[model samples]
Target: MMAILIAMVFKLPVDSGERNGFALTVLLAYAVYLSIISENIPSTSVSVCYLSLYLAFVLFLAAMSVVLTIFVLRAHYGTGEIPKLLKILFNCTSRSKVDVEILEKTDVGEYEHEENKLTWQIVAVGMDTVFFYVYVVLISVVTSVLTVAYIIHYRSI
Candidate 1:
């Protein structure tokens, strides 16, 4: 997904100001990978530091992605036509009344805010739910074995 988004930025030939948007998107991709490694901080003191840094990085990446998305949208379709675009998006849904309400409620700021919020919510909840159901349920009985090994090795001096 990050690759696809970055490709799109290049495809659009983003302006000088917007070009950093693409770079930042790529950087965020790396940040996520780095975060995964940092998640294993075993030392109690550095653990909090690593966790705090990871959270900050995640938030920064999220904000960067939102800004990049807005820049992409503006470059792709100009803000003037967003109402019509939103109307089309709304109409495509099954509920007409709900669609009108959506269209009515979405200006650039609101649209971006809601869109980013929903995207993150969906990703966080979806991954967590899937992990719990698909992985945790299947492996729950054996988790104690793995947990004990990890604690014995990583949590011990």
Candidate 2:
């Protein structure tokens, strides 16, 4: 299976960051699930009203988790505050040598496609942007689907 192949190829180990990331991802995922449930349920029904409350609860939980994550990351890095760290994150490439080193390790590859060794850089940069755009579009489509599905469900009931 592809999963087994990936595991063998990467051999990545789970760490604290991975655990926190997974938890945050799951919280956001639950927010999406609750939003869908609340959006679809009939407004007149008690259960539907409760669904709205559930959606709000999940959204709050996700927000709190994100805030906690920001605090933890800032504290761990001794970055002073959230806003400053965010600025650093945005300016990570030019401002932080550690960030540059990490990027260099990941972005620079051994495989050479063209005669020059710069092929990996081109592929890495292009693939990163491509994936970002693809995911953004995918998220937009999902939001659109949710909106349409909610409207249709509301009209049908």
Candidate 3:
């Protein structure tokens, strides 16, 4: 769980200049975690209800991270290098849907003249960063509180 959280932190552009690699590592870690849990469950007769809940939350986090990573990579590096299956799954396109003639006629020079103008790509990256932080914080807080509560409850009995 901590590894996943760390990997997520590392995925952010602020932490690591690259995100796709860290995201892939996190996904692999998640797969290993799931495999270990599955292997342990059959040998133990103990109740796994709480474990299942944790698993669900982790799985959700993993899925969200995967999606975020895909979007970030596509937005930054583009879809040209992405696999055909993944490109299809993500519905990625190499170029914008807007007509080339329209772009050619537009006053792109005027926009470039502005000193601090925000572009769509910058906005998208900003939004992605905000969402990533919020998701990580929310999951971490909830997991920590639940873990503490569970420990206290078990100790009382």
Candidate 4:
């Protein structure tokens, strides 16, 4: 089903940049869904089939977006090591730009710098998780409301 496909696509091994790209794609898809619905609506009554389709479409979009957002959050915050296959697929080489001599010269300083960087990364991951959950909840609520309204309208007709 569409939901399964969306979930699998989100789960695909990729770097942070690629994951962000997928998130943007989800947003674009939701926009397209909205445009399609707006174009179909008119002052006159709409068909049951059309309403039903709209409900299904919005629900699908909502589900995809919600699941995708969760995956994004996990990718950003989860402490799991990246798989070797994923590193290869993403073309990630374990090469550091820092000079070995410089690292050796400032061993204590380098450790402090690393600790600071880790703290900042944790804070960033926390913020991203909160933002993603808020976005997903808002979109899901809006889509659910629209779907319910459409169902009520269809029933009344």
Candidate 5:
């Protein structure tokens, strides 16, 4: 259901920069996944604090799995190069316009509508880029917090 919703909500992105952004997010998710699983976690029974830390890490991974899955799906849709999102931001704005004569029609309004769509797509890509950075920062912060928590809990044990 979520996948279908995602597909329906996000129009098929054409910009190489946009697809690059999606692929980069997918790569970042995989990197975080590696970081989480690479830790030398102990299985020895300890205090409740340690147990809770372990639980938190597990839960984080669970949540990350969902995010990673979504990113991977989107990356597959965006078959372009590597990381690059700011390209759209430095290039587009509210006043931006597009003129593709190939997409024009006998009716001038039709061409205007297509031009408007192209302009909006630039904005959309910019928005997605912002979301990409936010997610990366968020995951990094959570990972740091949980790692620190684990170390403190282990030392106390």
Candidate 6:
């Protein structure tokens, strides 16, 4: 996992096949871990520091991914389009007129607040592609380096 994130940080050009394989491997590893663990946690073996660090990293990654996604969507579509995209993604099972009406009304009311919040963020992160990539690369590198150091120091001993 650290290696893969480091590769991304360095802009290492992996072919799609290798990327797909790596993604598959990570997913399978997680699936196996969930299946074997049964309960929520080890309850005895995992150190608190490691568990907390891992959770923090996961949360950080999720947040970064969300912001990056919003940037991508912003680039391709205007602020007005997001509500439609969100509706499509979130309420795919819409089957009634009332639902559609409520969604539209909510979108109209929320657009102003969203627009104000989104403008600065999009400008801050969307200054240039380089800046966006740099943010991701820097965070990934920092986290991966810590994780690598921890593993080498504790596990390799």
The TM-scores of all predictions, comma-separated, are 0.27, 0.35, 0.58, 0.39, 0.34, 0.34
lDDT by residue for model 5 (1-157), tens: 1112222223334443354354444445545644565464544636344434544544454354445534534544554443445344435542232233324423776665664343333444444444445455555665567778889877999
Candidate number of the best TM-score: 3
In model 5, pairs of residues that clash are none
Candidate 3 at 80: error in angstroms? 16
Better of 2 and 5 by lDDT: 5
lDDT of predicted model 6: 0.44
Per-residue error for 92 in candidate 6, Å, reads 40
Candidate 4 local lDDT, 1-157, one digit each (tens):
2223333334444344465556556556656766787676774665444544544664565555556556545655667556556445333322122223234656776666663232222333333444445545554665577778878877999
Each prediction's total of clashing residue pairs, residues at least 3 apart in sequence or on different chains, is: 0, 0, 0, 0, 0, 0
lDDT of model number 5:
0.45
Tens digit per residue, CA lDDT, model 3, 1-157: 5534633643366335556566666667777777787776765666555665676667667667767766655565543344556444333432233123234655877644742433434334444655566776777776887789799879999
Candidate 2 per-residue C-alpha lDDT over 16-93 given as tens digits, one digit per residue, 9 for 90 to 100: 355356446656666677768767787687444533653464455445545544443444444223354444443443
Residues 36-58, candidate 6, lDDT per residue (tens digit)? 54456666855555544554554
* RMSD for each of the candidates: 13.8, 15.6, 9.3, 13.5, 12.2, 14.5
The 10 consecutive residues of candidate 3 with the worst lDDT sum are 93-102
Worst 10 residues of 1 by lDDT: 116-125
Q: Could you tell me how far off, in angstroms, the CA of residue 50 lies in candidate 1 after the best superposition?
A: 5.5
